[model samples]
Target: MRRPDVLVVGAGGSGAALAARLSEDPGRTVLVLEAGPVPRFPPGFPAELRDARLVPGAWPDAPTVRAYPVRLTPDLPYTAVRGRVLGGSTTVNGGYFIRARREDFDRWSARAGDARWAYERVLPFLRVLETDLDFGATPVHGGHGPVPVGRTGLGHPAVEAFRAAARELGHPDEPDKNAQGVPGVGPVPTNSAGGERINTGTAYLLGALGRPNLTVLGDCSVRSVAVERGRATGVVADRNGRRTVLEAGEIVLCAGSFASPHLLHLSGIGPAKVLTRAGVPVVEDLPAVGAALSDHPQVVLEWTPRRPVAEPAGSWLGGALHLSSSGGDHPGDLEILQSLVPMAGLVGRRTAVPGRPLALLASVQTPRTSGRLRTVSADPRVPPRIDYGYLETADDRRRLREAVRAAAALLSTSAFGEVSAGVVEPASLDDDGLLDRWIRSRLGTSQHTCGTVPMGRAGDPSAAVDGHGRVYGVSGLRVADTSILPAAPLRGPAATAVLIGELIAHAMCTVR
Candidate 1:
């Protein structure tokens, strides 16, 4: 085997896209190492991964799901379902592929001090990643690309009721949910086609499979980045219990949000205290490696159906409505997503609802409260401690209160009344104290985690990576994944993760 020009860590959504895009130039050999199993071709994937609708831990549980135990509020212990396969979470995600809004990029650009982070500048890259089946002709959408995107599960009666109720509440219909769409009700643009989950490993890496310049190795977990002096030389990895040293000209960490920071902590590139506690030699005391944790905190509002509805045949999610919590303060700050069918067995029996519950997941998009991701042990096999400080601030609780209030109003509408009998338990939005407590009790993740390794300029003590996705205090190394995002975008991070990989690859190619 030849030494690769670029060694991408973790063949998830970002890593797969970066590796495949880098290999476009046959001269530069690209290699990707994924902790989970990855197949060379689409057919090599399992049947569970083929369906775009079935989330691994959702109702009628499917295989190939890995759950990491984390604390939602220190009091609330939750297990986050993550995809351990080649495509990362994309292979198992519900396929919500909505792009981050312009406001989101404005924050990114300002934080990173780079014009390339501007929404307009990054728009072209997003267009090149997906072939939108619904809105391809649109100027903002891509007509020919690797990933296939379209709308599904909208035909359900519950989905229709949710849309009608939102319209009744005066929320206008914004059909296009991509970059061009406004904050309103519409079908969610998903990266699913023909009932199959067309994830990055299958979409972006499909062509690079047999290419001479690219090699994707799965079941190979990188324990740490081998940083010699100030440059990243390679990685210390274990492939099925056998440890080995792999060298590359440049290294890229694309291990998503949770694992990427964990890798950095293990590599002794984080806070000195963490390194000392883990008993690892501190290489660089970058205190920002696992700081500023941001996630979309979600609270679900359920309604028992007036007339019983069957289990949904397609995707659980169909339509979503975006709103501003504080008018004009934050655009698209509140996302009221509809789960058309109840996740009866999503979490053992805890998710079981009465009368086929129709759920509306109210997620606080722009949360003011941030948390921390810390290392508790040196062993890479042991997961890190995640302290999600959700609803810790009065402002965050206020935003979530508004979302719950909005969702409750939608469920009470006549359109919803036709389908819903009444709101179930925790409909206590009448009192501010009760509503605040409700927000705390139900606080959960939208599965969109970011901001651990924030993108900022040099001398910013709170930053871990730079605008060009390069890690500070390290040479010939970069991180192109969700962890490098300045904050969690208003939309799901699925599309944004792919966009990050594409944008980072373009930047690297330009530099080369």
Candidate 2:
């Protein structure tokens, strides 16, 4: 096959968006290679797979004990979950949309020396990618965007109760969380259209599949990037045991945070010692490719409601409380999410005649604990070692405990008092250590991994890529995905990943 103008690796949220954008010009040849099969949504998904009570290890696509087993460090017991399908983790994530906070971007600009990444500049790209269902009159959101963003129509009973309690607790209800830029309790804006998941594969790749210039190949695992004279020429991929070398003028790595850096290392682009130990030639001595990883650590507070609140038996509620950590002084630095499901004990048994089974989940969004991702072996088939390092700091534990107290206070309110029975996770209200024990046992990844290949100024050794996402020592290769985030945001990473793809496509177009 001939060389394409651009080769996009990993047809996840970022790659799909980039492929669709490049196909619009009808001039450039774009090739997208994905390691997993086509995305499958609900209704077609198995009933067992849809059960929320099952642990992360039981989920078919979960990375825990399935395809990509996470190697948890002693400090943290949580497993990291990431999807391997064409749409990537977005296919399985709860479709919540949260724009990057201005404060968060300000920190990134100062730390990374990229003033263009300030929230003001990136907001336009975010708006361009979304078609807000509630508020489109504002200039920040576009009405004709390919991806549809809207509110939830059928909310779980626990969600409604949680919202009422939040309002009673002096929190104002936000009509549109995506609009007005105010943090409060209300329905989360989702990336769904008509109650169906609108993952990147459905919204972007499939839409552009008809174009002749764009070719999408699924079930093709990339072995390593092909580099020559510090320039990426193509990739060495294995399609079900068949090896082939595909060439490209420019290469873009959109394989989530972990895979992208690991793939680069396999291609001899990471730390010198790591490649040497793995018996791979050193193409570039980039020491920061897999360092400085960060993720949100969640401590779940579970409880059972008193009354049967019309809760759906087999559905999941994506409701959450967006609050500032400030007791009352400033906007919150943390987020509290609510999940309504049954307990593992009640999975197979039916609820009693008088009392129905239900569980309430409350979690902290922005965690202080930091983690790292490293290559376990040079073999591309082996998953990388993931050290979540959850609750490794006093701040993380303190904030989580505070979040639990806040959630318990909300449940005690009149709105929730009418429905909730008692706490289920801690099992005892007097035990102060119960929350800590529960968190260590049930904590898991929210599937929003990032910051493995961070972007910053040239002098920063930890910064693997430049502000424009170009690798430090490699030419004709760039990374335009969540891996480029200097710091993980407090909300969903999907919207930001798509925005990165759009920004990179625009940059590539202007550069040529």
Candidate 3:
């Protein structure tokens, strides 16, 4: 893996795809470095990591996940956990592989000042990333792709009730959540198969393993990107407790929302004032690096079921309702996701709830609030201070408040009555003041972090990277991850991250 033609940092969701696609050519050499080590294939990983129903990352002692202290609000302290192992968050998530709404790419295209990012322009790449089990070989979805996309394979009584409740409440039925169809209740597209989370590592990397030109090394921590002469040529890493400087013709970072931007800061490719304050020589004074943090600020509503909600052996996230907020310009901006099983064990600590619980996750999909990330200290080990300015705008607060109330209504319907249970927390969301306080106190994140390195045209001072993810002030370096997203997608980012890898990989190949 020495002097690989292409070096991908962080073998998570996007990194796995980037390495897999770039290494397709036998002539191109690729090396992927991951900090967290786990079995690349089945039987090697622990049981909790294998199944999405387990919600492995929430466990206090889980090794594959890194829990970082982040502020969701002024006084609300939260833990923003990011997957550290191969396949990234996909390994630890609930297998909600829903695609980014078409509107998401519209803003991306607008910010980049390029039409190539438009939904129509990017649909083919989207098709290339997934094999849609529900609708295959269609004009909109792919049939033969590396990643397998299926919908609500598990049967849960509550999921059925949730769907029925949506219909009873006059919401349309959206069978395929991945489609460009209208917002409504629908099955959550999952990337799992045979009860195993088929993460990007399994879908893209595993298939291309053993290739002479490809090497994947886990437990290798990249201390900094080696940017010499204002160009990224390689990375200085700690491999097996030894300092190693590995060079590459091109370096791509797919370390996700937080880690990717964090790496750029460590490499001295960030705001001049911040890096100088940290005592690190500036490689590039990119003001936008880690400046515009966008994400979904979500709150959980977990309740105890009438009886012990019989557990099911399937994907935990089975159904969801996407609806527009009152007076909102966007569609499906307010979300209420239904979990097939009790979620008290998963995120109950955030809500101060404990016991077998049925849950509804609500959030404002299009938050106007933008947060910031700053490298407080030069030490690479010292994590950046992430100030997730959640619900800063009155509009965001209103939309999220509506979504939470909608979730309560859904739970009150006869559909939920079948499994009728008592409320777990916030005894009442009766008044606006009380609800707002509850929201701030229990606020959390979907972990769909984006826009740290905003994508825009050259003249735009806020722009850090170009539309193709090339760093503005550096050469031989590119980023293909959720961090490049101008904002969080309406649904989730798992599939979008894969699409980004395929899109950027193709662009890199074309340029070569």
Candidate 4:
């Protein structure tokens, strides 16, 4: 077994970014273990995966798509979608390149008691992760970086109408959604340029393929961390039916929310009860390893267009509207995204359309309900039991109801009179009780899972890692993905996940 300077698990967005930045030293050996096949570089990736124009599931959910069964309620169960490929979900996601709002960072800073996680402190890392084509030269945006970001052009009349409808409802038109302050209804910056998805693998890994110091092993499934004498050692992985123990001086978990926590528990570093139930020897009694799973549960509304819409064959999500569900001080709490392609299936909406269809997806920005992921068995073959516990709180339900109504209002505006014929789904919008029921039955995750191994204050019992991403009771082990987010970011997690990799890579280099 050869020990590398750094072993990064999961060669997705953050994992790829971390590996690329760490390998920059040329002196340090960086090994990336990806559980999925190595995807082709941009312009060469599969048409289904590389096309930025459609929502996920444009292609049939492949074997690489890990659909975890999630218990949304006691009686209801749904599948949470995640990509098991090199680029992770970024390959399949809509490529909405939104940044974490100022409030999200401020709240994290206050809760984690680490000012370094504040908005201003993290801005540089965010800037270093993207090449913002729209707001490149701005004070808040970045010019040259790995991920290529560009404004999703509003070629479709329905999409343009949706943005105008938002503004008609008093929401100002924001030119760049990824810029500072609250986002308004306008063009969203996406991680795609020239109709190709630019995931971390495309941006960070492909260019660094020639680096001798970096070794990326695709189709390698890591079974567990190799902990020795209360310290991190390496990992045991199964590659093509062959088991191998790869030693590492340091292990960084970039396996996202579900896998990162599952990896920790498999390594005997989770709740004692969970470990005992799973028949694994308890190495560390970290209660927070698989707890506090959070995500933005969304309700989608589909509308039939009276006329034809000329849309490009790229991203469906071109523009969005961010406003308050409660109409309170927090205006960035609800998000309504406009999609030229049909996205009703994502939220359990099924109806035969009379004409061309468009989508408006409304989601609670910050959810109050939290869930957990428990190891079903010691065998990695058994997927972890995940309970999103969505809409469990009164506030969440109330906000979702408000968001649904807001979506309806946006479509009703005169701005959409030419494109939109009528709202086609959600039969219970008029009645409060029926609308709540409809939302509960149809709500789905935005695929932005986070906080399964949340970072918090050092002494906090729920804190799995410190603000610096160091595991509390473990040495030489860290987490640098959405898993370490104390809560869901204000928007999507892809860009933030890449930023986290940059921050962690910088910290690792500075320390050694």
Candidate 5:
């Protein structure tokens, strides 16, 4: 493929959505290059990927998955799992599809100097990407769109107790958690419409395959954006050991937070010193391309429910609770999630505490600590080094410690009296020091990675991309994924990633 109107690298959530939206304009041709295989049939996407009960795609050793090594601490190394299939990490994720908080957009707007990124401006783009089945025709939700989002719908006894417990603690029950900035306990809105997961490939790419102007080339790894004279012309991709220069009028990097910056560095578009050390020639010395990596830090706690769970085999996550740490009127900075399934086997090689049948996860929504992504080599096949730098800051440790304490309190509420027997971990939450030690040992990723190639005001030296996903010091090259996020949103980044795809497509189309 040569000289297409637009070339999109990595057909993950953002790339697939951008390609589909761009193809709607019949005058322009779009090509999406993906590192994973095309999930041609329903069976092509593995049963584990379809099952919401298990995070099979999260297994680093899984044959179908690609896991990156992340150094959470200097002594501890954890695997950051990303799906290597058509829909990217969406294929392997738990399918929690909630929008970013309004403050997230407001923050982006203040930094990027682009009001288009503000909550009111970006909400329309979010609406264009989803067909909300549960909350139809709301002021903040879309009634009809490609991706179908609805409540988990599965009713479990323990989940009901959890919600009631939240209400007892003064957090009201929100009918739709995705609605206009509601901080309360409610059923998790999932991307799964029926039983199967609704990923980007299923929602955006599959139905649009018949479009003549759109082409999806899967099982292809994009080496780098082919740049000449400070402008991107195309990408160098390798498919089955065959290297090809797929040229385009405009190149969009949607390889995600980890891969997007890696691709940029490989193409000589990152910090000059790092590129030189990696034996790559420098094209543009942008200091922040692979910097400022951020993800939600979470600690999982298991409990022993005294009564039998109604449906243990059903959906794992029954509901979620969003609360503020400062007790102010802003969106929640802490999230406590309930999972009906046992998650002892999920974390790699952890001793399982017996008698714990239920899982409760607490995540710090706005993490103060950030990390970096660096290249081991110039080779695209070589996975980059990921250091999440979790809980490095005094603020992060303090907030996360408080979050753990909050989760423990929520479990001990009167509502859990009918369901839970007692806390299964730490032996006792009575000692603050013991609970803090337990939290640090068990902290894990919420799988919401963002802010590597962050978007900022054009003049800001730390900004990799300008307000509208265009990389600094490079033309015709833009990043349209979670990697472009300036910070981790209050909720999961998937829905916000989709909104970004829509917004960027609109920008690219009008620019053309």
Candidate 6:
């Protein structure tokens, strides 16, 4: 087996970004192995599918080329979506691009004992990888970068109404959410340029494809990380029914939250009980490999507009509202995102009759409940058990209730009243209990799954990866995707994942 300088598992957002950065040296050989093919936005796919692919479900839940239907459990009424394509979830996520809140990083640093992860320290990496469209003599943004960033156009009428409603609710206009540390209602910054998705693969991998040192293998599923004597040497992958061993000096797992930890367990790196129960040998008794899983659980607050102010069009809305919980001083707990999309089914199902369009959207930033992903079978092909313990805490329920109230208040404002019919979520706004019931029934995931392989101090038993992203108790192995996030940051995880790739590339270059 020929060894490359680096072998990246899961050529998603993080892997693509890392590959692009490492290829810049022209001397280091980087091999990216993807379990799925490169995603091409075919014209035949439904508009809803395209939009949902951008928002959620970019990662295929099944191990096939076709997109499969996702089923939601009782606890999590919303669909669980993931991308199986080369670009990963970024290819299918809503392009809403917002940086992680300073408070989020501060909390992570305090909890993980890594002061270098402070907001100020991470900003340089964020700026380097981003190309802010709203940049011009602004110190807060970078204009000349690979990743394009821009705002949605001001053509939508709902955008105006949303902004007016925010102002009416005492929220100031924040021109740029990516600026230093401000949060308010403004145009959503997206990764879309020229009305098309600019995913990580497009921005990173595509640009580096000409490099001779970088080898990209799509449609190849990595079965397990090949670990010998507590060190990762390469991976065992299945490509077109043929098994092959791809050797590398270092192995980095960028397979998102669920898959990364599952792969670790498959390679004998998880809890002894879990590995033993699955009839697999336990190379390490790391109980925290698949623990500390967290995601943003949201509750939909639907409302119908009275006068047709340009009826709801696409799931992608131009404007949004960022509100903090009533009790919390920092803007991290809960948020209210207003979208111009009707909610009828798992995917936005629209009716032909043009009576009035419904707008249903919610943001649940602070979640009290956490879940774990455990392998049901020792077979690498079997899917892991996913239990999203939604609304399991009084705090989660309270925050959700508050989020609904906030959404309702925004709709009731004078701005929305001009074109809004009435409330649709709580049917009867007077009763809080009724609203709570509606919340529990209609709540779903925001598709931001993270925190499975948390990064913390070396002595921390729960920490799967170290501050530098190297997997603990294993050499030449690291987890560089959302799985390394100690917690889901305030903003979307895609951009942060890109930053993680850049950080990892720099770390690897320094060590080499």
Q: What are the models' TM-scores?
A: 0.95, 0.89, 0.96, 0.95, 0.95, 0.91
Top of the candidates by TM-score: 3
Shift in Å, residue 6, candidate 5? 1.0
Candidate 2 lDDT tens digits, 380-453: 77777777666776666666666666777777788877667756555544455776676667665556677889
Per-residue lDDT tens digits of candidate 1, residues 1-512? Answer: 77889999988789889999999999999989987887877888877677655565442234455677788886888777777778888987777898888888888899999999999999889889989998674678889989988876566787888889999999988888785566999888888887777888989887778898899898888999999998999999999779999999999999888889989889888999988998878888999988778888898887888886766555657689998887668777899988755755344323224555667889989834387899888898888888778777778778889989998998889998887898885757789998887777777788888999989989999899998889888898899999898788878889999999999999999975
* Model 4, residue pairs in steric clash: 52-314, 52-315, 53-314, 53-315
RMSD of each: 2.2, 3.7, 2.3, 2.4, 2.5, 3.2
For model 2, name the residue pairs that clash.
305-420, 305-421, 306-419, 306-420, 306-421, 324-332, 325-332, 325-333
What residue runs in model 5 are displaced by over 4 Å at the alpha carbon?
Answer: 312-314, 327-330, 345-356, 367-369
Better of 3 and 4 by TM-score: 3
Where does model 6 exceed 4 Å of error? 39-78, 309-315, 344-356, 367-369
- Give residue 425's lDDT in candidate 1 (0 to 100): 58
Off by over 4 Å in 1: 57-63, 310-313, 345-354, 367-369
Give lDDT: candidate 3, residue 383.
89
Give lDDT per model, in order: 0.83, 0.71, 0.83, 0.82, 0.82, 0.73
Clashes of 3: 0
Can you write out model 3's per-residue Cα lDDT over 1-512, one digit (the tens) per residue? 46899999988788998899989999999999988884656666677777767677676457888888888877778888888888888888777888888888898898899898999999999898888887888999998999888888536777787888888898999988888799999888889776677888888888788799999999999888998787888999998879989999999999888988889999999999998887778988999998888889888897667765655556777689999998858888888988756666564322213345778999888845378899977788898999888877788788778988888888878877777675576667778778888888888788888888778899789888898899998999999998888788887888888888998888888975
lDDT of 3 at 110: 89
After TM-score superposition, the amount by which residue 177's alpha carbon in candidate 2 deviates from its true location, in angstroms, is: 2.4
lDDT of 1: 0.83
lDDT of 6 by residue, 119-204 (tens): 88887888888888767325577777778888765567767887888899888787787774456778777776665667788778
Residues 209-238 of candidate 4 have per-residue lDDT tens digits of 899898888899999998998899999999
Candidate 2 residue runs with Cα over 4 Å from true position: 39-58, 61-66, 71-78, 154-157, 311-315, 326-330, 343-357, 367-369, 427-434
The TM-score of predicted model 4 comes to 0.95
